[model samples]
Target: GPQIHRRTLLLTAYSGPVFFHILFYYCQAFIYGTTFQHTASQILAFTLITLHFAKRIFETIFVHVFYRLTVSFYSLYLYLFHYWLLSGVFMAYYIYYPGTCSSSISLLSSALETEETSLYFLSAVWIFAELSNFETHLILANLRIRYPRPIPKGYGFDLVSCPNYFFELLAWTVITLITRSLASLLFLIAAGLHMWRKAARKHEMYKKEFGSQYPKYRKVLIPYV
Candidate 1:
């Protein structure tokens, strides 16, 4: 299996949306405005999605420490294709094709507009989760730099072994709440399940490294969930 740099992999994953979504929106707004009307919901959704990917790209380069983390090219391609492109298609269908005979798609736009107060609250929660996740990554990166066995503690990490994953799940949960998109909800569920399994594996590794010293109260992805 040929290996690819984690940084390269992450950059590619995020770059897909930054490139495709922007182009998609531009064409929909300027080039094809006669065919597609740009609504507030679509603009907001696009901003939120693009900002999410931009934050990821920034964090992958500046916050996370790649170290010797190299994954197979197949794994990279799987993630890039499944998440970046496929997810974009799902989002585009809901956002851009509102008049395409789907009541559910029409409902998504209405949900965002109708739930103004709830959306604002959820946006705050999302921002907090994003910052918390970034802070957790910084803690882990610094721990690695200091050559210490990484034992995440405090903040979101006080309860879950993978607080970053926890916050990530929360962030997506908020996004689903704001957009009310079935596609994003489904994606969140799938990603949360995958993160849960990975967190359990990581917790076991911590146990192997620290033995009884590992936090016994710490759960895997969520606390007592």
Candidate 2:
């Protein structure tokens, strides 16, 4: 019944950003010619985006229990392609054209300048979502450790069947809001749809596995919404 190794899928998906980010870094100097500029906004976006993928790689390698799940090669290819396309478009567009959204990087060089309450609020929300997501992952990983085959619970699980998915969606939404890029917004929509379906499938499976013992009040993905 096994098709492709889960580690293969995970490493392939996460390695994509390393390739694309390097390509973009070099191309920036070549295209823009020596005067390769990095703005504050650009730096912020880069740090956040890079950290996001790095965390995913770390979690996949250490936190997730994927040994039992068999994924097709085609599915791995699809994962790589989708992330590459989205991440490529986002990094290229945002880093190169920092002036396109919100304020220019120079003007927003310091918090004192271009004092915006909304930016801080969105950033706070983003950090919160990321930390919460990581906590959920830890819980999931611990569950697998305690049981041969674990059922994920705790944290957001008390409300929704897939708290990780919901938090992931929220994190991306915050990044999209921070960037105010339509491209990123579209990526969020696509990712959200995928997560929604994944959560539904997971919920169905839980019901089949646990029968009526599964939480009756749990939503598929979102909590109370």
Candidate 3:
């Protein structure tokens, strides 16, 4: 049953990214007039995203539903596990073949476009966002589950509440900057804001529920409050 459940979760995670990739390929072909090589590269990116998403969803469903894991534990597992995989893969690629992971659009060009400072800055921001997100998850896990065994009060208030949404927003914002595509930027911005609003509501819920017991944390979109 556990194995079957894990498989289902993996499918759910993979489906979204696969759908996004197909959509992205068609859109790029229509809008940007991408060549066959460019389309193929986009397909590869799609596969990477799909793999990451599948692992995340599998951990989430398996830990929470099958094993009766705590929210914090599952959240930490999902968040950290995905980033670890992504960062590891990215680092390996970057180290082994320095310039190979650059824009796929220029794969077939005689002279590939040089790297811009903005691209570097964007990549830095992405790394920071991932670190911050993983740290938040770790903190939440420790606060909610690792300390005392089944403390009911811990669940009443969130520790570093809504950090997932915040970090995700920042990550997507960086992605937009890196990609520099209007469609991608718009999608990220729209999705980020939507998640921001949802996180704010969650904060309000925690405050209402826990009152003074909730941590005296700043309520900014980013950690800088």
Clash number for each model: 0, 0, 0
lDDT of 2 by residue, 1-225 (tens): 437878768777877876665556557656555455565445555666777888888998888875476677678768876787776655455545525444632333355355355556666787888889999888877777675555667889999988999988998887775666777788889899999999999899988888888888899998887
lDDT of 3 at 178: 41
Local distance difference test, per candidate? Answer: 0.73, 0.73, 0.47
What's the TM-score of every candidate structure?
0.85, 0.83, 0.52
lDDT of 2 at 7: 75
Which stretches in model 3 have alpha-carbon errors above 4 Å? Answer: 1-14, 22-34, 39-55, 58-117, 141-160
Model 1 residue 6 lDDT score: 85
* TM-score of model 1 (CA atoms): 0.85
Candidate 2 regions off by >4 Å?
25-27, 32-36, 67-70, 89-91, 102-117, 148-151
lDDT of 3: 0.47
The deviation in Å at residue 36 for candidate 1 is 4.4
> What's model 1's lDDT at 147?
64
Candidate 1 ranges with C-alpha deviation above 4 Å: 29-37, 99-114
- Which pairs clash inside model 3? none
Q: How do these models rank on lDDT, best leading?
A: 1, 2, 3
